[model samples]
Target: MKNKRLIQKRRELKLTQKQVALAIEISQSMLSLAESGDRTLDDANKIKLAKFYRVTVEWLFFEEFYD
Candidate 1:
């Protein structure tokens, strides 16, 4: 499933994909893919995204989606 919360949080923060991707050390395309549920985020990226978004990993990747 797509990471709707992730997308929502990013939008709530008024962040562009590039801004978040750069902060998380991932390519914007990769972030887009993950958000769209076309790809899974690895552990490192999951952690980075959770941290950058100020959320828990569980909150970000809920219900074992990419866990």
Candidate 2:
């Protein structure tokens, strides 16, 4: 469940966990957990992240379907 796509997107955007977290108003630790798959992002946060990354929520979270 590790959100490797999320991590990849962040790296592609040249952003750090802290930067993304601050932009989305979440804690860095929470972002870390999401990226690491230790926790799942809530629906609202998932939408926020998708918007922040300029990606569709499906692309961000359900890449298998895209494949």
Candidate 3:
């Protein structure tokens, strides 16, 4: 799922939750919730994260769920 992928990519990039939150202009709590699958990202944020990770939006948003 997107949540798992987000967490995975965050780890791969060696980004602390605070670092990822700051880069994405979100709060650390929000990022934590997102990684735990307690919340879903807004479309704009999905796009931003995709770009940050150099991944296609499809890969970031729907890869695990859809494919």
Per-model CA lDDT versus the true structure: 0.90, 0.94, 0.81
Candidate 2 residues 1-67, lDDT tens each? 7888999999999999999999999999999999998998899999999999999999998878887
Which prediction has more favorable TM-score, 2 or 3? 2
Candidate 3 displacement at residue 47 in angstroms: 0.8
The per-residue C-alpha lDDT of model 3 at residue 31 equals: 78
Where model 3 places Cα greater than 4 Å from the true spot, the runs are 65-67
User: Which has the better lDDT: candidate 2, or candidate 3?
Assistant: 2
| Native RMSD of candidate 3 (Å) | 1.9
Candidate order (TM-score) = 2, 1, 3
Superior by lDDT: candidate 1 or candidate 2: 2
Top TM-score model? 2
Report the C-alpha lDDT of model 1 over 26-52, residue by residue, as the tens digit. Answer: 999999999999999999999999999
lDDT of candidate model 3 versus the reference? 0.81
Which ranges in model 2 have alpha carbons more than 4 Å from their true place? none
Check candidate 2 and list the clashing pairs. none
Return the top candidate by lDDT: 2
